[model samples]
Target: MSPSTLQAPEIAMRPALRFITCGSVDDGKSTLIGRLLYERQLILDDQLSALERDSRRHGTAGEGVDFSLLLDGLEAEREQGITIDVAYRYFATARRSFIVADTPGHEQYTRNMVTGASNADLAVLLVDARKGLLDQTRRHAIIAAMLGIRHMVLAVNKIDLVDFDRAVFERIVAAFNDFAATLGFRTITAIPLSARFGDNVAERSQRTPWYAGPPLIDLLEQIDVEDDRSGKPFRMPVQWVNRPDASFRGFCGTIVSGAVKAGDEIVVLPSGRVTTVKEVLAPGADGKAETGDSVTLTLTEETDVARGDMLAAPRARPQVADQFAAHIVWMSPEALLPGRSYLMKVNHNSVLATVTDLKHRVDIQTLARLAAKTLSLNEVGVCNLSVARPIAVDAYADNRDTGGFVLIDRYSNETVAAGMIDFALRRATNIHRHAYTVNKAFRTALMHHKPAVLWFTGLPGSGKSTIANLVESGLHARGAHTMLLDGDNVRHGLNNDLGFTEADRVENIRRVAEVAKLMTEAGLIVLCSFISPFAAERRLAREMVQTGEFIEIFVDTPLEMCIVRDPKGLYRRALAGEIANFTGIGQPYERPEVPELHLLTPDRDPAQLAQDVIDELIRMKIL
Candidate 1:
């Protein structure tokens, strides 16, 4: 149906199908998309004119039109002439609607392909009839299968170039069908077509008179996708608040799956609070809504609901847990190791999660998953996740909205993977019991102010203390209760026993972070100036605070500058072997790659830097 036809009343409509094109770089994936769009007449007049202009501009290379150029928009992509990231395109046909994701073809960019096909309902795995089943196609199909996309259409593209030979097409089709069936992709549709010549895209080709089947578009439109979101309870993760009126705030987000009616008993996840829907609202006077509709929902009671929380029918509420096993596809260059915490984005909620164990590495070729110690980039494995807090979710097969998540490296902030949750935690691996003592409010009552921690980290003589002292004085003058934890001061008491060794350094940061955490709980702004040199340590310290508490000020003065401004002659003595294990002299300090505040030495003025930090805090509503 045309998009305009979707506006018709009293007609039961089929939902749009989301699919991805997977093949080698020159396997005609892009050409297939362009052909599909062309036959559907989706291209605007001006757009076609622009395409002609670009064709003339580029002098027209290759066997046919450079259809790959249609999706490669990045300058680097156009220059290197390869798709890197996943590119999404939307178009509708007279029979059905389509959402296509174009993925990269490079072997190294297999991670990109997994990301593209993760949310797809079907995958159009293209193959060059001339070059039957390449390793790249096999790799992509394995990932798609692992990610739970069952339906695949084997588009044997570029058959026209092969003289439209029936024997050739049949041989390639049989080989791929056998491979796909072996890989557990049962519903494989092997279609013969030439994407460049627009044969069998929207219309059945007359070239192969022997094969009698529906056109590709007919199969796409006829395929049932209602079951994708059907037979499940209502689930809509609150994405934003629509405050059309100050008196009321309506929860707004796309209905991920299932149906909801007015007065449906809804349960807010991770909280177990129950409430009935007061109204299921759309702009129009609608009776009900299915999946993919953006609507506002008002509850009976004014319960505190925000982004990163799921709203579901009370009868089918998802399971809550702090640990779960997932089939994780590693997407980063770094290896997944034990004791490293990853930032997990489960549904809309973000949590600090660590892996309990690396179960096995999935052998894509042999289909035998082997027990392994680690997973590298583009590798698939089953691993267990342990979150810092309890999260409500469901099995991926039952509910994709609640079951999928991206794992981010806590230290590097790089998204390491796309994970499909298997089931709820079999054994409770709780990070901590849900307990709120000395809450943010209670801390404010005792301290008589709002709590914040000025986390200063730098080399030994890089002016961290100088800047922190000036900032503390400024905050004190402003009637904000502030405490400055200088490394010198801490060495006299709490961290006195600690030393310059790696273990002692880690312990020092931990102690300081805990103190800062406690001070934040009491609603006091504390300034901490220490040589907390490690990125991992600093990130862990930041994660300790709930919000508006930890402020990292990186005194990024150069080592040479620190040595020159060594007020205590520590740098001079360290060079002369008097001061042992001194930072910037003997000990290594990992610079703050992304510091909240970057400040130079005292000669550049510390008071101004402190004021800048204060201003930033106020602007972020953390003051």
Candidate 2:
């Protein structure tokens, strides 16, 4: 039914409840939601007719109107008889209105479920009575809790399959309750129902006369999960700076928490510039706006406020820092490795962030803390991150809107993980960069030459180190200060702790880049030779130095050629199953899209390729 038609005088003032239904595959989440809407007479007549027709073609029920067809609307979902994405439906009762999201139950779609649960205040977790508390059922519940859902409904669905036995219902509820106790849910209500037959959904079931709890609809209507954010600290992220004419300048955004009024003192965050709210403009508002209200407010003065900045109560400002600890839910197929840079979008700001450390990963089955170097798909980990700049944030426990963030792959632009900030690291505020007077300019003047890092990257046995060494020897002969950092030589000293794993390879390149940056500052020509398989790390190394200070030299040797000319015999061992994560043999190598110099090494000698590198550096004016 339309909410306007069913709106009662007393219920008109009630806030809408947003919830999600999720569990393992084929646990009847869609069917339960469809039955609830159908029982309330919310479906239109034409929709009901379509459901009847579609039921015959794709129905799991035997010659009955398949209620699941209402929510499983996708063509793929209908063909497979399962939910692949989240489906949202709006409906109303005489007592309340609701927005319910039916999230997919498949394990591969766990990321989809996280998206659905991020905004829900309550989670109605379904479980097949016959198969009590499966792995995915626990996974969804844990994810719901991690996303700040405190209220839950443990709907023991398909009870008819287990004959509605009281013992069966109690056992399932007991197991869930035992596991959920550690999840920190505020309220968990257990109910037994048969969603297919519409028993104990909108009304109590006659078959299960032993159960005494209220029906699903009644429980949802009565459950109090309201979060009065208007009473908390005021926080509004600036989405736009509106200036239609010279006479007006306004900041426009939705108030994420607390309330605001004209003349209220506010501070622009990460800058801490204080100003007074001159006026509040909101449609149908009375000079005030609270949480969830999108409004524009003019400042008393021309303060430096821009998009991605936040306005907050002056005395209760959010934390501003560049380093923090957080819980991340890895979403991409590629594993999350430490030291790899990603773009993190928190609220309205996008910043370059790197996972500094992966403290521990949560064991999905046992929820135990285990030391881990990286996080795979659908895994949860506690990690430390360092952002490119300081950002205003609150702890996730204090304010979810400002504290939660998503990591986007810098190269692919794919969302790789969702993270919730725990707290800022104390060292972030304590450590400060000390300025030095004798800078790179002074060193360059004394040395009579510009400093640059010539980076050599290629497959193993591709003559990267030999070419780098030759170039450094030529520079040294020309009375230029030079240092050659070969991959094997540095691994034996500076990067001895690292191995051939992807995570270790990333760190190895990161450390070498920092060293190269330092050498450039000292006005010394630096030659770095490494098998930097990942393009992202090459980009990272390039960004570390000043413009025109980093030159990428790609020794383009075919993999087969490298395998045949393996002077170190590493490729043979790798192909013989003795070496793991060996680039070009076991681990995949991501070639550079565009390098400053691509010296094909198959037909040319190493000395000629080294001369090609020297010629390119001279052409780029780095020599």
Candidate 3:
């Protein structure tokens, strides 16, 4: 039986179907939205008047009601005649309620679609019948799949422009299905419609006698949506700390998953600290509330917890890690390269981070794997990340709530990229069964002392290797086990196969960082002197070891001093057009925005600088 046929008559407070619409500017998205709202009688008279006023404001068509003007908000967005931010609308019929997200329709704004569809249970991808299956369609579909949106409805809009030709609709559906088959989405309900003419939008159309199916709205009302949160694990990310009084402390947030009750055992993440729920709070109710309800929860323990911490069932807790692997989408005009740090925001929480390594770039057009050194604008790639602080996270597949993160420029606060967590590096494991017996103490004994790494990052010929060797000899005389990875010595042998390109520079630093990490793990004081040049690479090397185990000592030698100290004369040749990728002479070097320690040259003696580095290490208590 049809669901509406036997349903009790009542108002729907919340939408049963959550969907978003994405298409190019000329695809008539706003017209379709207007049609849905108008037919459902959800449009307020004031809203219609506002749209009319806006229509005349933009010198729109008279009386006919400018449907496009309905969605055009913001002067800049309307001036450009495109959607900017994701606009949400709500409406309902006698049966199921509808929540629609109208997202921007530009190739560069692919990241916005991800944000819109991340929470959507269904996605309605409208395609211009005249312009059959475009790249935007594929891009939107893949994003919906990536965000775990399974249900899909391909609305073949603008059928009136196509002369109601059945072949045109079939051809478009065939093309989309041909490509979409490769991905994980199979439940697609394609329909023909003309939002401008109001055909096949609310009811079955008489225009297309050959096509017999329920209208777009009817299909939406009838389609089954499983929001059964009863069986799923409970998750509540504390978004607000509500301390109504000093005596009452309540953690407030929306329940994204299963139900929780008073006195239930819950664990706060990244800490593994367990506690009991003292109060299951509704805004003002004591009764049980299911998922999708915003409420304040008070735990039994009077322990201190604040925003960015999550309350979930202890058994299904998320991983706590300071570093992780993720699939990142580069959205900024500036390409994403290693050796640069970014701020990562996961869910409601944010942290500082760096793209340590780019694994492989995914070809959106062909779905082929392309080996890339850096991520260009609007590119998707797998990469490793080292965060400044620990984040409580889960795999994108397991839980979208904690799996996704956004990369922001640390200085500017501009959101540069969006990332999906693949796995955590220092992921919390079964402490009961697993053991980390090889701690820092075990490594220190084997190396005859403690494990330490000297990370030197600066412009080329900054006397990094010269000072490193001198320090290594001094430390050796004191019977300190040490290894010196000079830039010239290692490049000639260990990294001889690598080049001096931007991609090669990242790879060189990555290999060196890994070697230093291994050396520290093996309990040796390793002096890694390289013109790594990028602050991000230096930070990654530091993150690999425990606090104080890795030290960043910047060789503060001027470019002119480096040119004079160039034993290979490479810098001089670079200035004379003999070399192309020489740092400080030909290529640009990003000065260390923040360094742990700085050593000056041509001003301070080499011995003083070396001793200064040693003194800092001893003070840090890592010696």
Question: How high is each candidate's TM-score?
Answer: 0.68, 0.98, 0.78
Off by over 4 Å in 2: 1-9
Clashes of each: 5, 1, 0
Candidate 1 lDDT over residue span 1-623, tens digit each: 97666654312466788999997777877667877787888888887776666655541344345556677777677677678888889997655678999998887788789888888889998888888888788778877887778788988888887888888888988877666776666488878888877788888899878667777787787776555574578888888877878788788887888888786788998888998787778876274566878888888898888887888888878888888888888888866764455789977788888777778887766557798766887788898888987888888867777789999986677888888898877686444446776567976876655677778888877778877888777777777887788888888998787666654666677778888898777687888888887777787788888755677888888888888888888888999998777777777888887777777665567777778877877776655
Across 336-408, the per-residue lDDT of candidate 2 in tens digits comes to: 9899999999979999999999999987677889999999988888999999999999998788788899999
| Model 3 lDDT on a 0 to 1 scale | 0.79
By lDDT, the best candidate is: 2
Clashing pairs in 2: 1-42
By descending lDDT, how would the candidates be arranged? 2, 3, 1
Candidates' C-alpha lDDT = 0.78, 0.91, 0.79
